[model samples]
Target: MSSTAERQGGSPGGHPRGLYFLAGTELWERFSFYGMQALLTLYMVKQLLLPEFAENVWGLAALRGMAEGMFGTLGNVGFASVIAGLYSGLVYFTPLLGGLIADQLLGAKRTVTIGVLLMSAGHLAMTFDQLFVVALVLLILGSGLLKGNISSQVGTLYPQDDASMRDRGFAIFSTGINIGAAAGPLVTGAVAAIWGWHAGFAVAAGLMLVALATYLAGQKHLPDTPPRRHADFQHPPLSKADGKVVLALIAVILLTMPAEITYPMVWTIGPIWVDSYVNLGFVPATWFGSMDSIGAIASAPLLVMFWASQARKRREPDSLGKMAIGTGLVGVAALGLAAGSFIFPAKDSVPLIWAIACYFLMGVGWMYYWPTTLSLVSGVAPRAVVATMVSGAFISPFIAHLAAGVIGINFKRMSPSAFWAMDGAIGLAGAVLLFALRPMLNRALGTDKRKDAPENAF
Candidate 1:
């Protein structure tokens, strides 16, 4: 059924009012999500995950002894990295299945509600040490449902032909996300510093509860989700032509893996770096992670406007090209950090300016890619299989974060400069590959000098 606003037929704005509601919901949801993210790595290493507990729990002592015997000592940093990787990777990976469930069974509305509730429960569960793993599981599952579906719902607001509006809508929605991301860590980190980690988590739980209320109150204003008949989990087989476009899109998405692998550096290794090397007494390490979000929130409007202006002038780069630029920017950002690391002597703190510069550049780089990818995937997906295709794009991050976990393990093993430089090169390489494949990708995805291609066309 069409919303009353839609039925009224003379809506003042071309867009739906529900968009703002959804955007607000997303803002708070991200606030909760990133707030927890900022706390996760440090909490595991410095607070909850004790070595004695590890040794006593499920023969982990023997495993650690074996690991230490082979690869020196597995310190808290390494353990924290592994945990961060596992947590982050699961967050992305489960969205693949979550998107499917929404499409095939629950519909986007119910799925997102369930996701928020689960996350709220998980945040509350974080207060208990015994329920830690359970909390993680709930969070992972909740994020999977909420993350993809909410964005998917945003697209549903616009008609299929309104690509420009959809893209702009996503940018606006992304701005909300960045805003939340920026605020969440700052608030949570400050609270944690003042009170304690559990207190910080309690704040997150409160925020999520608030988010749920906000979403529920505004449900009428949001886009409607058509009821779906539950069916056995099965995707309709793609035609050969559809297969080519999907394969191409997947290939391009996979190209982002290298940059994605390094994303955790800001959160996983960042706190440790600040504590071990930077030695900034007044600023919390979680605040450094907030830099990326702050930068992104600041830059999103400018970038979105720039893209819109470029599109009007017919000078806008294709999505693949934009993503390539983003990939390179990440490398540049990493290089900036690497340079800072080179200048700062070992065991000494670098100037806060260096960290800020690195994070700001990273934020700029992410602006070039992340929202564009969301718009791209949402725009190109076949209507019958939209969620699945979005899920496929998420696979890039899934692989990246999993690799990040492995790379994070070695953060303490390698010099900071060397580690940043190596990953910088990886991002640069991915950029080079993507740029080289631009022409082919444009043809495959059918964005070159053309109107919208048929949904199944190569």
Candidate 2:
């Protein structure tokens, strides 16, 4: 369907039918991904890395030796954190390759299909103890293929001029992400607790199959991929202006990395923290990983409504402003953790309310920045390289996860308050830098002219 037709003939709720389908695909994909992620660190620390199980996994010894050689001796938790960081970081990093493949070779649809199949295989591989590393590799490769292309397609669902609708559409799509993220850990964690970890992985594999089916069912509704081009592909030259815009986008992405670095702690070491220090009664520690998603899911609609109201009053912050605000909020959330640690120094003494508050703030921060970043890229990126740019945007998270991993190694060595305070400092510094660089960024991104214009004018 043409973008014009899709927009004009949108569903009763005024969105293209394909949006929901894509969102549904993302929902299931995230369900599987997050389900596995919620289990990964805990599984490693408690089961997989133990001598009885670790010896069974092929090549694990070599992998451990290599990691230790680079980062010094790592006990089980520290090693798990590093592996989780590498896995998480690589997951985002691969999108750059996936984007290129989609743009130059296979086109988005075919690439996405391949991604889904690989991810499904990865999830199934998780069912076998010996296939742990193999499973991670498959999942990373598959995510690299799927993430950027799927998101790029969402931008194609709307008329190029309809930036407002497109932004709202991304918000809606992100809602699907949070929904799956919220539910995945809850369901899978419970399953693992009751029936063991492999059973949880089996469930993820099943959900991934459902994601593939959803994408297939919606294929006709999705935008058709343009024919792949290979001749002179190595150098798709751009105008001077487009080149500047690309550089500006990269800067913005880099500035966002500090906030990104703060994010993985909630998943990588978060479960372990909760398991060791929080009094949860019967609740699984992995359930804490879902708190941010739940907060995001609840707040998304309210945020959209709030932004809409501001738009009507001609007082809405621009995308850059929103991002700065988001980054600040993430920093504040981290500070909240630091405060909790200081006040409740005894193990498991931290109030549950404090952790919940931290996750809630982080969720709000994510909503403010992430969707805005996606919408900005979709709207302003040169058409020739939009998909590639979208994928490149994910590089922030890639950098963040790698850094987070390195920083996480200190989790065992430092006091909780000190560690969290350091993270808070990083996020706050990024927010300050982004705010200071706003004018330069706006001019470079060519958004200076639209600063005082209507939100839709962009």
Candidate 3:
């Protein structure tokens, strides 16, 4: 899926090599992402402390007898929750800086490399307790650069006429993310468990190095998918009316991020009011935050195919329509959160099935939300700054998180039930806004389907 659809040079075994470059790069990139996720929390709560192996070390003695239990000598919940949420949250939030470096100076390729190097360095830095703060910074920066740019490059592989392949490309790109996320944990978790968390970072760096090597080896395959230069891509002619629509979308995204961040940041505010309403809030918070990813993983391929089929029938959803629905569903998922909290009452875990159900429902909803936004952004952005535009897409969440962290810390005094309800209410607002703007979006961007185009469904 390169920019040029001419497919010169004998089709390279019937498909462009850029696909492999993206596929491999993403695979390794996800490994790093997931690796960090698996161990990040444990690292912060346990590894960074004086006894690196306290959980395993301390728990080993208690295990002389039969069953596994939640309690023994354990880290404090509030402090640990903050650390875990912040680490995961910051990774999303800091991409703003990463996106900037990539756009202005590094380009996606170099940006990814620098990010990986920093990641490896950060992982290594974990060995020194004093360096933990610095290590976290590097890891966040690396993820920010790598996450947004790599996907942008994937889109760059196709020309505007080729919208059909976008979904497929995103699907493949996302697969790389999941693969990395899934593997990073399995591999790093084991390594950290036995050798040390530092060892896991070393392994993550090695994976990134390998990913880079794979990209280099496959560079020739991506000749048609050359890095986008500024000044080529142009915005669709924007009149005052069109400009208003664009502004509206910006507003929608801005509002959406805080709501999105709240899914993960709930506990930050829940404690003050949670005791009065639900017995245990973590169960719901974790479920909602984690639901999006798990849902993305589960539904990506299925939704891609479904959308492709719709496009074939010429009944495809335009970008705005997709966003509208996706946004609505996110809001709907928030309602589910509200209900579960209500049903559980007095600090209890909602039925495990409720969490699973929420994950599945939200997963499908996000499937529509993210790729559609990306496709819409691609359609509207000037080709010259599409890289930067895409970088901005990644940056939006970071900005949102900075706001969320502050808001979350302060919002705790409110009731937990009210808190969950408010989250749902906001998502609904985004959906409505996006839906209302659909006509403008369709007029601005043209049809969303390019089924016969070089780009595949993302």
Candidate 4:
């Protein structure tokens, strides 16, 4: 009944029908998720809220976006563009917590299902303007579950030392996410713009449902079993020493985000809020959101090719090392945004290409970070902690987003350049954090560079 047997024990690349089914499910789920994600900030400022502080900053951003689009140019604004910076920043932060839960409690299969379901509900909830905040809470929580665990499962499909195939496998998996991102916004935004915002949420919900059903259909094929992990409430919690370690870990994470936290003070109120301006018909706005996704999509083949290029080398960077470099470079990309502001000061918006370049670089950088990280975690993490780690990784992005919305929103209203600069610093800090943890990773997983290391697995 296992996939190996289903394909008559063929290689994973030639996995049985269920693998494709799982892949399809993920593709659809990502479509719903990214579609809604594409429009969130815009919707927040334009349609969801009123002419309050939140709306003001968002409104200005929208106006700026409109003006630049009209004149065929984008500009940098006064005060940090905290809202934009924070939203972008957060989407990555929450994953740490999400990944942990998946590794320790939910297991890959259940976590993904529950997370996807929650996200689907969250999207549906957003359709209710009155319940906007509640919807956000649900979406963040749901993402914490689904985003981290599902990715880990993809890694779990193979053995840990199977280096030759892991990168290619992840490359295949990441595409499902990009495919969703590429199509989601265009379709959902068009629907929402022509029909209503609620329609967008509804479409997202429908897509998630399809993903969910698709997941269920192949339930028999998934090797992971999580229900057993979370059913252990009788067990005592970690010791005080462990608790302190967890607290310290959190402190480190928090300190890494100061610019991210502090910048929103001005933008929410000053002159640039979105309600204070006009809306650019849906297409361009949605298209702008699609930029990061496009970057993500563009990276898959490129990274896979890069991995292939390394084949001739005696010491190829392992998944972990590549992830480290990728994430660190993401920091560099953020810095590029700061540099962009310097290049084009006081215009209505930063050059579209500047933002686009940032997105593209970021996509290439971060694209390699997670897929590889997941493979490493699945490879070396003790079975007991695998789901937990996944949950934490997933949760980190949610954490990033939650903070982004609360603080980044306010920051964008204040100083724009500072916003871009802050994200660059954050990306760098995340890279450093991983680098610092390199010893732990190296010890447990074996070096990614060594061809003699363990088999490359899921």
Residue by residue across 1-458, what tens digits does model 1's lDDT show? 36434622443356676677778888998898899889888887876669554443443455456546755667878867766877898999888777778877888888999999999999998876556777888999999989888888887878777788777777678778888999999999999889989888999999999888877886876666755665644567887777787888788788888779765677788777766667566988777768988887778778879877777766777788788898898888888778878889576478887788788878888888876786688667665666667778788888788788768787878898888887788889988988888888888877775663222321
Give the RMSD in angstroms, all C-alphas superposed, for model 2.
Answer: 3.1
Candidate 4 lDDT by residue in tens digits, 1-458: 55444532554566444555567777998788778766665565555444453343324546446544643332232112333444444445555666666657766777778877888888888787765655666777777677655765666565567655656666667677778877887788788778878888889988988998988887776675564444555445665544543444333334234222322221222123222221332325555445556876777777767777665543456655566677676777667756766666554445555566765676677566655655555554445444554444434444554454444443334444576567567667766766676556554444544655434321
Kindly list the per-residue Cα lDDT of model 3 for residues 152-222, writing each as its tens digit.
Answer: 66766666566776566666666776656545666765676578777876777678778767767765555
TM values, all candidates = 0.87, 0.91, 0.69, 0.67
Give candidate 3's TM-score: 0.69
For lDDT, the strongest prediction is: 2
Q: Which has the higher lDDT value, candidate number 2 or candidate number 3?
A: 2
Q: lDDT of each model, Cα atoms only?
A: 0.79, 0.87, 0.58, 0.58
Checking candidate 1 for backbone clashes, the offending pairs are: none
Q: Across residues 1-458, which tens digit of lDDT does each residue of candidate 2 receive?
A: 54556544747468888888899999999998999999999999999999999999988999999889999999998899899999999998998888878877898999999999999999999999999999999999999999988988898888878888887887788778878999999989999999999999999999999999999999988888764677645546799999999999989889889889886788898888778777677888878878988888888779979988888887788888889888888998989988988888788888787788898889999888887887788679998887677777888899899989888888888988898899889989989998999878988999878745554422
Candidates 2 and 4 compared: the better one by TM-score is 2
Q: What lDDT is obtained when candidate 1 is compared to the true structure? A: 0.79
lDDT score of model 3?
A: 0.58
Instruction: After superposing candidate 2 on the true structure, give the runs of residues whose Cα lies further than 4 Å from its correct spot.
Output: 1-16, 157-169, 230-237, 451-458
Model 3 scores worst on lDDT over the 10 consecutive residues at: 63-72
